[model samples]
Each structure stands twice: as C-alpha cells, then as structure tokens.
Target: MAQVSLRRLVKKYEGDVQAVKGIDLEIADHEFVVLVGPSGCGKSTTLRMIAGLEDITDGEIAIGGVVVNDIPPRDRDIAMVFQNYALYPHMTVFENMAFGLTLRRFPKDEIRRRVDNAARILDIGELLDRKPKALSGGQRQRVAMGRAIVRDPKVFLFDEPLSNLDAKLRVQMRTEIKKVHQTVKTTTVYVTHDQVEAMTLADRVVVMNNGIIEQVGPPQELYHNPTTKFVAGFIGSPAMNFIPARLENGAGALRLHLPEGIVLPVPPERTKRYAPHAGQEVLFGLRPEHLTEEKPTDKANIATFQVRPEVIEPMGMETLVHFWLQGTEVSARLDPAVPAEVGRPLTLAADMNRMHLIDPRTERVL
Candidate 1:
C-alpha cells in the first residue's frame, strides 16, 4: 500500500487556459478518497494527472513518497478503471484478468495463482470461462475490478466507474466496491458527478467547482455546515432555500423580515452574530429538513413561515411540502401522515439550530 500526496498540483492547457487550480491533498495508506463535482468541473482531469495519464503543468505529485512527475503512466505503479470496461470481446474472464501479468512475463504458476485469487475475491471463479458479451453489466464491471486486483498496484483510480449501469445495479455495485475496499485497503481515488455516490462512498469528499477546489470534508460536515453558498446549494437534494430578508433588531431578538407580513424570531446565538449590522440585507439559507409542520417555539426561537400551500408530495415515510415564501418557491419536509391541501394557507416553523444566515454581498455563510 502507498500514500498519495499532491502539493500545489496544477494543470493548464494550451493558451494558458487553466484546468485545475492549485490543489493540495493527502491520501493516507489504505484510504479511499473521492473527488466529486458537477460536469466540466475538472475532477477527471485531476485524477488523470495523478494517474500520470496527463502531464502535471505545475507542482508535484508523489506516490509512496516518491515524486514521479517525470514518470510515464505504465511506470507510475497505479491502475485506472474507466467507465467503459475496455475488455477484449474474445478474451474470457481468466485471460482478461491475466493479461497484465502475462505481458510482464510472470511465471505461469504465479499468473494462475494471482488470477485465481482475484477471481475468488470477486466471486467470479465460476465465470472464468465466460466471455464479456455473455456477462451482465455488473459482471463485466466485476471482471474489470478483477483485472485491477491481480495487478496489486499501490493506488486504484476509478473514473465514473458506475455511470453506465442501471440505478438498482449501480447501488448494488456501490456496496460491492466498498466491500472490496474494506478487505484490500488499497489507496483509492474515485471521481463522480453524482453527489449521492460521493456522499456514500467517500471517507473524505472533495467538492470541486469551475476547476478549483471549493471545499473538502466528511460528507455530513459538508451537508450540515457549508462555508459557501454554492456548497450549501449544491450538497443538498432539494437544494437549500434562499430568501431575501431585511436585517433588523426587534426588542432583544434580531428580526428577519419578509414581504409577506411575516416576521421571524432569530435565536440569541444567531442574533448575536448578525445583530451588529441591523439594517443590512442578507439572504436566509435553510434546508428543507430544517422546516417542520410544528408551530414555531421559543426554546430556540427559530424562524417561521406562513404561506399558502401550493402542492404536497407523499414519499413513503416523509412528505414534501411546497409553498411560496416572499415570491420565491420553497419546500419543506414533513411527516407523511399530515394532511395538506392545495391553495390553502399553512404555517411551518423552521429549526433555529439548523438555520444558516448568508451574506448577500459575499454569498458566504455567517
């Protein structure tokens, strides 16, 4: 096993068009880290640079503590699994897994031992003689993994390895990949645009935007405490609700005023942070889960919204509430058992501790 490190790593294309801004990351021995972002965000470029597929225009990349910026991909001691299986149609599973070893002139006994061991680990020993065209999508993926397993490289680089599978199969393969990582514990870096995949599979997730590193942290940390508005809006499923509110002081509590004749009580902690700038205009950022059907209370003096309900969606355990607040559409998650009506007036209270205040000018969490 090896530890991967990138210090001030940068990549630039022709005409000085920057692809990846300086990125500094440390992947400890036997750790699984994921690089995630939206399309055109340069996540794949970063992975390619690390794998020695693309040249590093600036900075250093080290695998097992050796700077290999000048090394070719075959000499980098890394294995990459692409979205496409890239398998030979005529080669059976055994031959496919043994191709790398065969090219290196490994002894016949050693190649057989390695391939068999990988097949057993992947539970594909029974399909050794099956061709790629005969295997299911998930099975072909397993064979690809088997190829990587026999190589026993220091680092495993996966580039959107599950994008082509069906939804159910994708989820199943996700669990299988995690199980494989647990047993082998090789340093792995996975890239994906799917936030759900990034959240579930990563020990640490790096969120990238516009070719620059926006934020990096544990999944829950990024979900609960986002530093930038983009991070807050991108990490959540229903996306965060952004409402323009006036910053004012009312008695001891800082008041959040809305155009719909609704005024919310900002808790002491929140007021303490925003009270100094009373007349400033700010954006109120709240998650859908933070708003509930219950009445607003004073134990934590959270903000409340009274609006006309537009639509309701019942999802097995919980329901989603849709309404208009201050001319902007917003949604809230509530118990599915609650009865809701269309075009009817309703009041929902938001959790104080779960609330976030963002500066409108800078678009940053306060």
Candidate 2:
C-alpha cells in the first residue's frame, strides 16, 4: 500500500556511536524487503526510523512520496509485530485483536467485524475466545499477527517476530507470514539477524554491517555473486569459505597459487578482473554448495584442494564436511549418500566458474 524510501538516512547516539551510517534504500509497494545483519549492525535502527519510532539524525524518509521525518509513530499508519508478541495477558484473543480499534474509538460493530475477519484469515477463529495464557507459543504468535492484521495499516513492519519461537515454530510462522503477505499485498519491511529467515521471506534482502549498507539484492544473487567479503560471509548459512591465495602469473590466463600443490586455473574471460592484481594477495571465496564430492564433468574451469576432515555431519539429504585449509577452518556441502570417514584426508573439487574472487585490500569483489 505504501512505498518507503530512505535517502542518506543517518542516526548517531550522544556518545558518538554511529548506529546507522548514511544508509539509502527504496522499498517498493507490496514488496517484502528484509534488513539483515549481525548484532548491532544498524538494521533495527533503520527500521525504527522508517516506522517513526526513532528520530532520524539526518536525511529524508518518505512514505508514499510524503516526507514523514517529523511525524509521530502512530501517525505513520504502520503496524508492527514485535518479537515479544506484546499481547495483553488478561484479554481474550478477540479483545487482543480489537484493542487497537477500541482505543481509537472505532464503533463496536466495526471492531468486531475486523477482529473476526483477522481471526478467520489467521486460522485462529477457533481460539478467538481463548486467552493468551491458554494458548501455545505458536498460537500466541498467530494471535500477535492477527492483532496487527486488524489494524489494516498501509505498511507492515516485523521486528524479529519469529525470534521468540522455537526453530520448528519459526519455520512454520515464516511460511504463514509469507502467505499472509501474498494475500494482503501490503508493503512490508522485516528485520532479523537470521539469514535463513531473511533469504526465505524477503523479495529483496539488504545486508548491513558496521552501521553501513554492505549489499542489497535478491537472495540467490547475493548468495552467488556477493559484492563484498562481509556480504559473502554474512548472507549464507555456514558462511562462505575464504582462503588466502596469491595470483602467481600474468594477464592472458591468471593462475592462483594455493597451498598443498593446489592451483586454480582461471578462465581467460574472467582474467580481466584479476589483471590488475596479478601476483598480489587475494581472497578466494566459495560457498559450501559450490564445492562437491563428485568429480568435475565440466573441464572448463575447476579448482582442486586437499582438506583434512575435522567434522562430518549428515543433514539428511546432504552431508556437511568441516575441515582445515591453509590454517583456516572451512566447511563444504557434499552428498549425504557418499560415505564419509572422520579424520580422513579428502579431495574437494570446486566449480571455478562459480568461484568468487575478492580483493583483500578493499574486501570487494574483483
């Protein structure tokens, strides 16, 4: 219903702690944009500013093309679901969902109609008469969502709403939230430190770090073609494997020197990016999925390595192999059906076409 835009937004504390450093983002109408990062990375601050919950130290914030930097939180017409649920303990599910409208002095019939509709849509109609104390954790979360839905705000903001639930319930609610968004098509901005949730729920993901916006893109694009080291490491589960390698040769075809007789033969077409850094130290990044146990069938570009296996974990369909490479610990995804032995030396093959080259000096992709 509303498109939110942040132009050079900034927030600074009294103690000179820069909470959010000049971040600019545009979230379109009906788009589910997720702000994700590590702890104290300014993601929540940015969300608060958009919701009018925090004062913007500098820059412009526009909602539906209207500048609302000076507006109050309630006047912003945004509904927020918090991590704590924040349900009234003594109130029944119906009252909890109707509280906002009642406070605004909406007619009794109108409040009832909205509450009933939200409850039905959330599949909590059966529990409408139950109190929060009598509901399970997942049920209470649904109640919280229903309460927000009843408000009928132009924009929906979720501030780590799934963090309070168990892992299984979190996954369930993640799906439910996505379904609800699809039904309502209200513009939404979600904030979380959980990469899995960010990747799964968002239409576009904004990766933040150290009070700055590191990268923003589709989940798969950010995962496969990260623009920086922080993004490459932060956006994926188990993180991307970073190994220090030196470019050993010149322009035509750059060859990277790796430990233990391992060499990465870069394709001629991709050598242009590494042309300036030939013979310089660079970081090689490869996601766990890009490294496989299977032999390379595509001879176009392949990099081989030797890893001393430290841990073997079977995740049903895939096995996770953790090992040490060049004094750094790294993990790889492999076929679970393949027999893995602990403490055994394993040969890992990487699809060089999918490999990433990052500059250590700038931490940016080459």
Candidate 3:
C-alpha cells in the first residue's frame, strides 16, 4: 500500500499550452481517488504524470513517502490499466497476466501462483487459455487488470479502464473493480470523464476543470453541497436545473422572483445566506429529484408551482417530467403513478430546503 501525494504538479506543452496547472492533491494509503472532468480538462495528463509516462514541467510526485519525480516508470512501483486494454493479441490470458512478473524475474512457480490468484480474483480462471483476440471487450479489460494485479505494485492507476465496454458491461466491470480493490486495498488513482463512474467508484472524487481543481470531496458531498456552480451542475445526472431569478425581500422573509410571475419563498435557514444578494439576479439550481409531483411530507419546506409539461418520459418506477421554466427546459423526477401528459398543466413541488443559490457573475454557490 502507498499514499500518493502531488504537490503543485504542473504539465506544460509546446507553444506554452499548459495542460495541468499547479494542482495539489493527496491520496491516502489504500484509498481509491478518482479524477473526473470533461475532455481537455487535463485529467489524463495528470494521471500520466503520476505514472511517469509524461514529464512534469514543475512540482513533485511522491509515492509511499518517496519523491519519484526523477524515477522511471518501472522503478516507481505502479500498475496502470488503460482504456485500450493494451493486451498482446498473440498471448493467452495466463501468459499476459504473468508477463510482468516474468520480466521482473520472479520464480516460475511464483509467477504461476500470482497469475492464478489474480485470475481467480478477477473470475477469469477458466479463460486463461484464450487469447485477447478471442475474448470479449469486458474480458479483455479484465485481462488487462489481471496483468496489473499480478505485479502487486504499491499503487494502481486506471485511465478510463471501462470506457471501451458497453454500458451494461461498464456497470458490471465497475462492481468487479470495486471487488478487486476491496481485496487488494492498494492506493488507487482513477481518471474518467464519466461522473457516474467517479461517484460510484471513488472514496474521494476530484473534479477538475481547465487544469484546475474545482472540488475534492466524497461523492455525496460534491453532489449535495458543491462549492461552485459548475460542480453543482456537473455532479448530478439529468443535471441540476438553473433558472434565472432575483432575490427580493418579501415582507419579513426572502423570496425568489421568477419569470411568468412565479415566486418561491426562501427557506428560513438559507435567508441569511441570500440576504446580501437581494434584488440581484441569481441562478436558482434545483435537481430533478428535488422537484416532484407529490407534495413532500414537510410542507413548510416545500413550495408549489404550476408549469405545462412539454415532455413526459416514463421510467417504470419514476416519470421524468420535462417542462419549460422561464423559457429554460427543466426536468422533474416524479412518481410513476402521477398523472402526467404533455401540454397539460402540472403542479410540482420544489424542495425549498434543498435549493441552491448561485452567484451568476462569479459562478459560485451562495
């Protein structure tokens, strides 16, 4: 096991294009940390730097309390599973898994032991005789992971290892990867563009944008209380709905004035936070799940509004209701039993206590 620490890490390219811009991060021993962001966000660059595959422009990378900035990849004691699987087509699964150990000159028996153990752990024991060309995409990925496991390195790095698999296979492979981690408990740093994978696999998720750290926290923390508007919008599925609104004083309380003469009172707990922004345009963010057709049990914390449903999608257990709010399309996760139809006015409840007020100018959460 190892604790990976990155201190002001930077990666600069030709023409002065900076890929990673002095980001500091720490990964605890046996911890699984995921770096998640959109394309061109420098996530892959950062991961490569850690793996010694890319030269760093500045700063330090320490693994297991040792600075490895000057060390070659083979000497750094890290195993990486890549998106392309990187398997040798000619080699059988067992040979592929044992190749690293063989190069390191482990005894023949030990190599067999390690390869067999990894195969059992990855549930690929029966397929050891099959070549990479004969295996499915998911199986090939497992073989790639098995190859990494046999090395028994101090850290494991995954660069979108599941990206090539189909959707259903990706989910299954996710569970397999989690199981593998629970068994090995090696320090891990995974990079992916999919937020769902980050949320599901990471002990802590690092959200990056434009080569900078946007937020770093447990998945739920980023989802529930994002520090920035970008995180609030990125961390959720169906994404949070942002409506143009202005905060205003309503008698003794605070209220949000929306277009179409809609008004929603701010929860008393959040009044102090929004008081300074009164009468100013702010972005109101609410998740689809927070807007429902049924009234919440806590009526005091819920506000009702009417909108014409523009689209209705039945998702078996729940219905996704799409409506236009102030000309912005918004989605609501409502109960499947709710009577919903396109072009029909629907009364929806917004969870006032769960709303987010964002500063439009700075794009920061209030």
Candidate 4:
C-alpha cells in the first residue's frame, strides 16, 4: 500500500473549458477516499488522470512518492475497476483473474495461488470456472474486483462499480466491498455521483462542484458542519431545508424571524457567533430529522411552530411532512404513528441547537 498525492492538478479541454481546476490532495496509505459530486464536476476526469488514462493539462501527480505524470497506466502499479465490468467473454473467471499475471510472466504456481487467494477474498471461489455470461451482475462485478485484487497494486481505482446493479444488489455489494477493503487494506480512490455511496465507503469524502473541490472531510463532519451552501444542500437526503430569514437581536438574545410570523430563538451557545450577523438577512437551515413532531424533551433550545401540511408522504418507519412557508417549501420528519393529512395544521418543534445559519450574500455558513 502507498500514498498518492496531487499538486496543482488541472484538466482543460478545447475552448478553454476547464474540467478540473488546480487542486491539491494528499491520500494516506491504506486510506479509502471517495470523490463525489454531480455530473460534469470533474470527478471522473480526475480519477482517469490519476490512473494515467487522461493526460494532465498542467500540474503533477505522484504515486508512492514518485511522480507518475509521464508514466503509462500499465506501469503505474494501479488497478482500475470500471462501471461496465469489462470482463472477457470467452475466459473463465480464473483465467480472467490470472491474465494479468500471465502477461507479466509469473510462475504457474504463483498465478494459481494469487487467483485462488483473490477468489477466496471475494467469496467467488465457486464461480471460478464460470464465464462472464453465466454470472449475475453482482457476480461479474466481483470477478472484476478479484482481477484487480490478484494484482495487489499500490492503489485501487473504482469508477462507479455499482451503478449497473439493482438497488438491493448495490446495497449487498457495498457491504462486500467494505469487507474486502477491511481484509486487504489497499489504498482506494472511488468516484461516484452518489453521495450515499461516498458516505458509506469513504474514510474521507471529496465533494466537487464546478471543476473544483467544495469540501473534503469525514461524512458526519460534512453533514453537520458544512462550510458552504452547496456542500450543505448536496450531502444529505431529502436535503436540508433552506428558508429565507432575518437574523434579529431580540433584546439580549439572538433570534431568527422566518416567514409567516414564525420566530425561533437561537441557542445560547450560538448567540456569540451569530452576533455579528445580527440584523442581516440570512438563510435558516435545518435537516428534516431535526424539525420533527412536537415531543416532550429535557433538551434545551426547543422551539415550536404550527404549519398546515401541503403534502404528506408515508415512508414506512417515518412520514415526511412537507409544508409551504410563504413560497419556500420545507420538510419535517414525523413518527409514522402520528396521524397526518394534507391541509391539517400540525405543531412541530425545531431543535435550535442543530440549526445552521448561512449568509445569503456569500452562500457560506455563518
């Protein structure tokens, strides 16, 4: 296992369109890092650059402490798993996994040992004699991964390896991949547009937008303490609710004045931090789970408000209640046992301690 580094890495196409802006990243040895973002965000380009498939327009890339900007992919000591499960049609799983070793002219015993070990690691020993056409989607993906594992390269690159699988299979394969990582402890760099996948598999997540990185941190850190509005809105499911509000100095304490006469006092701990932004128009941010059905609690900073539900969605364990505040729509999570319906006024509590205040002018969390 080895560390990877990118310094001032850049990728540009014709007409001066920059796919990846100059960015610097240091990936530790044996660390699993994920590059996540929307389409056209330069994630795939960055991955290909690291894999030596795409040339760097400028800047440098180093693998295992050696610069590899000019080295061909085959000599980069990296294995890549693509989305399409690029397996040989006529070759059996064993042959496919052993092909790389065979090309490198390894001893027959070494080839057999490596292939067998990889198959065991991937739990596909029984399918070794089967061809790609005879295997399921998940099985075929495992074969691809086994092929990579048999090489024992310095780094592993996965480009949306689960995109083609069904939802259930995707979840199952996620566990399988995590298990493989735990067992092998290879340095891994995975790229995908799915935030959940990034959060599930990454030790550190690099969130990219508009050809530049917006944030890089652990999953929960980015979720709870986003530095920018883009990171705040992109990292969560059902997304965080953003409402236009005016931050007011209510005598001695700080308060947020929302639409329709809904006002919530800021947590006492945050009053000092938000003091400078007082009397400014800021965006009030809260996740759906934090704004929930009113319940008895000993927790401080709980504020209550009433809103008429505009749309109600029953999601088995939790019901998603959506209401319109002026023109902005907001969502809240409630227990499924709570009776809910459209056009009914429901009381909900906002956990001020979990709230976020964002500057509307710069779109940065304040």
Candidate 1 TM-score, C-alpha based: 0.94
Candidate 4 wrong stretches, greater than 4 Å: none
Q: Which candidate, 2 or 4, would have the higher TM-score against the true structure? A: 4
User: Per-residue alpha-carbon lDDT of model 2 for 1-366, expressed as tens digits?
Assistant: 899999999999999899999999999999999999999999999988988989999999999998999999888888888888889999999999998898889999999999888888889999999999999989998999998899998899999999999999999999999999998889999999999999999999999999999999999989988999999998888889898888866546788776656788876777777788887898988888888785748577766777767999999989999987668777889988777788877778887888788889999998
For residue 325, what is the lDDT in candidate 3?
70
How far out, in Å, is residue 256 in model 4? 0.5
Q: Which tens-of-lDDT digit does each residue in 1-366 have in candidate 1?
A: 899999998899999988898889888899888898898888999999999989999999999999989999888888888899888899999999999888889999999999999898889999999999999999999999999989999999999999989999999999988998998899999999988898899898889988888888989999999888888988888888887888788777787776677777777776778877788887888898888787535556555666677889888888888888657888888877767677887668788677778898888888
List per-candidate RMSD values in Å. 2.0, 1.6, 1.1, 0.8
Clashing pairs in 4: none
The alpha-carbon lDDT assigned to residue 343 of candidate 2 equals: 82
Prediction-by-prediction clash tally = 0, 0, 0, 0
Instruction: Kindly provide the TM-score of model 3 when superposed on the true structure, using C-alpha atoms.
Output: 0.98
Query: 227-256 in candidate 4: lDDT tens per residue?
Result: 999999999988999999999997899999
What lDDT score goes with residue 140 in model 3?
A: 94
Model 2 residue 146 CA deviation in Å: 1.1
Best by TM-score: 4
Best by lDDT: 4
